[model samples]
Structures are given as structure tokens and as C-alpha cells.
Target: MSSVSTRASFTAPALALVINAFVWGTSWWPFRQLEARGLHPLWATVLIYAVAVLVILALRPRALGQLLRTPVLWILVLASGTTNAAFNWAVTLGDVVRVVLLFYLMPLWAVLLARLVLREPLTHHAAARVLLALAGAAVVLWPAGRSGWEALPLPRTLPDWLGVLGGFCFALNNVMLRREAHRPEEARALAMFVGGMAVAGTLALVLVGNGMASPPPAPAPGWVAGVAAMALLFLAGNLALQYGAARLPANVTSVVMLTEILFASISALALGGGHLDGQLLGGGALILAAALLSTLSGADAH
Candidate 1:
């Protein structure tokens, strides 16, 4: 009975994690398609998030009032918004493997920011995990680095930089979320979703207004079908994340979410859409190991 109960305990979150990973992993392909069809990824984000926001509003109009009443929630909005927008935009613009790996650097960010934001003490185990994760990031993005002062002890590629920055921001975002964990989970999820839309929309406006990118063109005939699918997936993914996040420790959740990198990397490789070189492979192992350690370490803490 104990064995059976132990197995059952892991079932739901495992399934949710897998589904979320698959959604995020394959998201890049459709985003690229939309880009090819003249719909910028930012605009694509806007479309999906708009649907999510509307759904949330329809279900809970009071959430809006709740959001407005809390300044801390606004801070949450900014953090989550930057995380989602920067991560999405960066992945679409960079190497899938690099972007995903860099984003997983959240463990490092979470540890440091946890100390500052949540007043959580940094255990030796957590500190070790942070260093391991950072080493892995450096290995993965090694190909992007160059010579002289230009070489800042990291990858030399522009996409690699974008991915690293995205990961750092992601870490900060999650730390902030955990700091505000006392808030209602539903409210947090709503803020994250709405914040994602606001951030993406604002960036899009700036980029277009500044003539950095062209305006979003009318999508092809089948665009609506794709958009619908994406919207449903986004809503489902967000819901799963919100639910799982509320139930689990942030460290554990971060580890579970690392499954997204595996899902994306394997799919990309299988589809001949991406490559796995030595640095990326080695770096990925380190990152995975670190995340797993972090999760397992936190398992008994709560």
C-alpha cells in the first residue's frame, strides 16, 4: 500500500510537467512559421495571450480589481512579463538548444534572488547547485565567445547572449514569484498571463514604432487554425504551471520544468531542426544534473 501510494503521488505532477515541456519545446516551430508568414513572434504572443486574458477575465472579473489593489502584484506582473517575453522572443531569435539551456540557469538566479527577495538562506547544497548550473551554461554557450576584452568569459554569439540574458531574467522572475508565494495562486497565475501579454505588446509596439521590425502582416489562410491551437496550448500550459507551481516548491518546479529542454532538444534533433555538439551536450548534462540535484535536495524540505 505504501509503494502504491508513493507511485500515485508522483503521477499527476509528472504528467503535467511532461505536457508543459512538450508545449514549450515545440512552440518555437510554430513561432518560426508565423514569422515566415509575416506575423512576428511578438504579435503571435499577443494573439495567444489576448485569448488567455479574455478567458481569465470572463471567468473572474474580480481578478482585475484584485490585481489593481496590490502594488506587489504589479511588481510580479513586471517580473513575469519580462521573463515570458524575453524568453519567447529570445528563443525565436536564437539557437533552440542554447536558448533553452541558458533559460534553465534559473537555479542560479533563484538562489541568489531568493536570499535577497524571500530572505531564504542559501544552503550549501543550493549554492553548489547554482555553481554547477552556471558552469553548464558557460559550457553550453562557449561557442559564442571571442577574443580580448570582447571575450567576457562566455559565449561569443549574439543568440547565446540573448539566451543567457533570458535565463537570468527567468531566474529573477521565478524568485520574485516565490517571494510572493503567499498570494493566492490564481491571482499569481492571472498576473503572469496578463503580464506576459503586456510585456510582449509593449516591446512589439516599441520595435515597430522604432522601425526595428516591420508591422505584422495578415497571416495565411490557415493561420487561424494554427493560432487556435497555439492559444489552447498556451492556456493549458499556463494553467498546469500555475497549478503545479502552487503545489510544489519553486526549486522542484524549476527542476520539473527542465524537462522542457529535453523535450525541445530531442524533438528538434529528431526533426533535423537542430544540432547537439560537444559543448551543448556536455553542458546540458551538467545543467540537468544540477537541476535534478536542486529538486531532489528540496524534496524533503517542505
Candidate 2:
């Protein structure tokens, strides 16, 4: 009986983490679907997060006050908002697998951000992990039949740039969360949700003014349903992440979250949003290896 109880406790949180991973992994599909209906991803991000923010406010009305009191939380808001906006737009326009791989370069950015923001030491292990992840990124970026300078490991397209930007912001977001971990959890959550709405909403307006992007289309049942469902899904995923991460070791949480890559890859391929080749496979392995190593290093530090 004791053994069974212990097993259940561990399994439940792990499963919750998986649920979070699955939501993000397959999120590209719904985003693409909304885009097809003439809803720009930036606008979609605004609506989805707006609903999520309302839900959070309803449940934790005081969270907004706490979030506003801490000025640093505003940085968290900006980082989290850019992370979502860039990622959602990138996945909608670019090859899903490539964009996701680039975004997973979070470990590379995390090392640098931690040093800068948290004043954490740049340990030898962290440096090596950064190099490994960079190497992987080079592999992914090297154009076929190109060599030397022509094969520069640079982002080649809008989506590629967005992917890298999102990853950088994501690393910063994580660092801020760690730096401010002493704050109330609800306040942190509220900050992130509000950031999503504020940043995306502002960007959408700017783009619409410039005619670079279209305004949200008139109300339709199909898109209305899609946006609502996506909002619920994101909210659920966030809750699951909080639950699982609280109960599990940091290393375990990191490893489980990496499954988002697998889910994204498979869904993209199946849905005709991405393709695979030798270069992508090899590069992805190196990136994931670096991420895994970073998780282990984090565990050691703890």
C-alpha cells in the first residue's frame, strides 16, 4: 500500500507535466487554423491571452495588485509577452520543426542571461553547454551544398529570426522568474498573462497601422470557438506546469518539457507544415543534448 501510494504521487505530477508539454507541442495547429481564417497571429495572441488574463483575475483578484507593486514583474511581463508573440507568429509562417529547434536554443541564452541578470557564475559546464547548443544551431542553419562563409549559421528568414528572438526572451523570462521566485505565485502568473495581452495587443495595433498585418476579421463562429478553445488550453497548460514543477525536481521538469519538441516535430510533419532531413536531425540532436546537459548542471548546482 505504501509503495503504491508513493508511485501514484510521482506519476500524477509527471503526467501533469506531460499534459503541459502536449498542449504547447501541438499548439501550432490551432494557430495555423486561425491564420487560415484571416486572423493574424498577433491578434490571435491578444484575444487568447486576454481571455486567460480574465480567468486569472477572476480566480485571484488580488494578484493584479501584487503584480503591479513589483516593478521587476513588468520585465517578466515584457519577456513573457515577446516570447509568446514571436513564437506564435514564427510557427505560423515557418517550418515548424526548424523554428522549434531554434527556439529550444533557450539553454544557450539561459546561461548568458543568468550570468547577466542573476549574476550567476559562468561555470565551465555552462560554457560547454552553450558551445554545444551553438554547434547544433550551426548544423541546423547550414544551407545544403554550401561551405565555409556561405554556410554562415545565421537565421535566414523572418521565422528563423523570430524563433531566435523568442528563445532569447524565453530565457530572460525564466531568469526573471528565478530572480523573483520569492514573489507570490499568483502575482507571477498574472504578470505573464497580462504581458501576453499588452505586448501582443500593442504590436498588432502598430502592424495594422502600417498595413503590414491585417486587423482582426469580423466575428465568426468558427474563429470565436477556436480562440476560446485555445485560451482554455493555454490556461490549462500553465496550471499543469505550475502543479508539476512544484512537485517534481527541476531536472525532471526540464526533461519532460523537452518532449514539446517531439510533439511539434511529429505534428508538423503529419500536418504538412514541416519536413525533415539529415541536417535537421543532426542539428536537433546536438541542441537537445545541450539542453539535457544544462538540466543536469542545474540539478548539480541545486
Candidate 3:
């Protein structure tokens, strides 16, 4: 018989990462939907991850102890929480395509973070992979000719900058996960869940104080129900991410996870009536091709 089952050990985590991608890809809609009902994205994140924190603590009451012993997990809490806060706010306030294009720049961040944190050597294959990923991002993010080629490739608006910030935080979060893979998974999960609550909750308080963002409105039954549903989805996605990311090399997980862009693109097109013009189609193919090459090369440095 073939060793097909043996091969599955690696392949399965790749598939799990894809599942995580789908959850995140379409996640913006629920945030925006909840926002429409007077729940700000920060508040929505607070509610969703708050539920996640409670659930995790209930299951593993001692999980917090491990995080206390490992100070690095606190960095994870900051990274993961800031990531959600940035992306959720950016997407709700800006064009989905633009925000996603900037956010998916995680591969660029990943290359450097992996080398720095995991001490993974940047092989020639990985160098080439990062270059290709950047090229694809250029294709997708290049400003229209309306700007007459003088436009900087940098993010201009507040939301665009938030997307970039979110990508950096995401890269750090993933790197931390790889570094802490030896620790109890429950501690890692608990740290991330609590980070969401702490970061978003703190920011929400600032905005409310400054009169920029509102408090969690009087909870209408409909919105409360929606928050509960989104929380459950977030919890599931978190578990899937832990399963895949903890098993795979950090860089490989980052590369495979770019499929989230594809998921986001399709969902945006369908829900927002976005037109799939030629440039978008071509750019997406380039991005996907780069990810495929990374998988085949398997330039996964530990």
C-alpha cells in the first residue's frame, strides 16, 4: 500500500489553515453588519472575544497560569489583540478591496519576523518567494492611472494605514505562536482571547471618552443574538488556527494563509456588488500563483 496516510501529516495542517482563511476572509461582513445596528467594530470585537475568553477559561481554568509563567505570551496578547482591532476597524471604515490588499502584505512582514524570531534562515527560495509575493501585492494595490503614476505605493488614508499596521501585528502574532509552540496550547489560546478583550476594551474606552466612538448601545435583542453568533464563529476559527499554525512552519503557514485574500475578494464582490474587472482578475491569479509556488518549494525553515 502507498504511504498516503503518512503524507497526510503535513497536508492536513495546510488544509486546516485554508479553513481558517475562509473564516477570516468573510469575517468582515458580520462586523459591518453589527456596526449597522449601532455596535461599533471595537465593541463588536470586545463582545466576540470576551465570549471567547470566558469559554476558554471555563474549560481550562488553569490556562492563565501558563501565560503568567511565560512572559512572551503577553506579547502575543498584544499582537493578536491589536491585529483584530486594526483590521476590524479598517475594514468597517474603508473599501474592502483596498483594506484587504494592504492587510495581505503579511508575507513581507512574515519573512523578516520569521528570520528574527524563529531564527529561520532566509534561503534563496524564500527570498524569491517574498519578492514574488510583493510583486503580486503591487499588481493588486497599484494606484489607478488617474493618479498619473506619481502616487506613492504607501497607504494614504487612516483606514489604509490601519490595514498596514494590522498586517504587522498579524505577522508578530504568528511568529510568537511558532516560538511558543512548546507551551500548552490552552495557555496560548487564552492569552490571545484575553488580549482581544483587553486591547479592544481599552481602545473602546478611549474612543468613548473622546467622543469618537460610542459605548455598547443598550443591547437590543437582535444585536445581542448576532453578537453571540459571531462569537461562536470566532471561537471556532481560533481553534482551527491554533491547530494549523502550531503544526506548520510559521512561514509556510503565512504563505498558505494568503488564501484569505481570495475568500475576501469573492465575498466582497458578491455582497457589495463589486465588479471583477480585468486588473483584479489578473492580480488575483498572480497572488495565487505565488502561493502555489511557495507550497511546492516547501521552503519551510524551522
The predicted structure with the larger lDDT, 1 or 3, is 3
- Per-residue lDDT tens digits for candidate 1, residues 150-262, read 55557566566666666676666666665676876667768878888898899999999999877767656766667778999988987777567656665677677777988
Q: Which scores greater on TM-score, model 2 or model 3?
A: 2
Candidate 3: RMSD to truth = 3.3
Task: Point out the higher-scoring one by lDDT: 1 or 2.
Answer: 2
lDDT of 1 at 195: 83
Give me the overall lDDT of model 2: 0.92
Assess each prediction's global lDDT (C-alpha) against the native.
0.76, 0.92, 0.80
| Model 1 steric clash pairs | 144-155, 144-156, 144-157, 145-155, 145-156
lDDT of 3: 0.80
TM-score of 1: 0.89
Off-target runs (Cα >4 Å) in candidate 3 are: 1-19, 145-150, 242-258, 273-275, 297-302
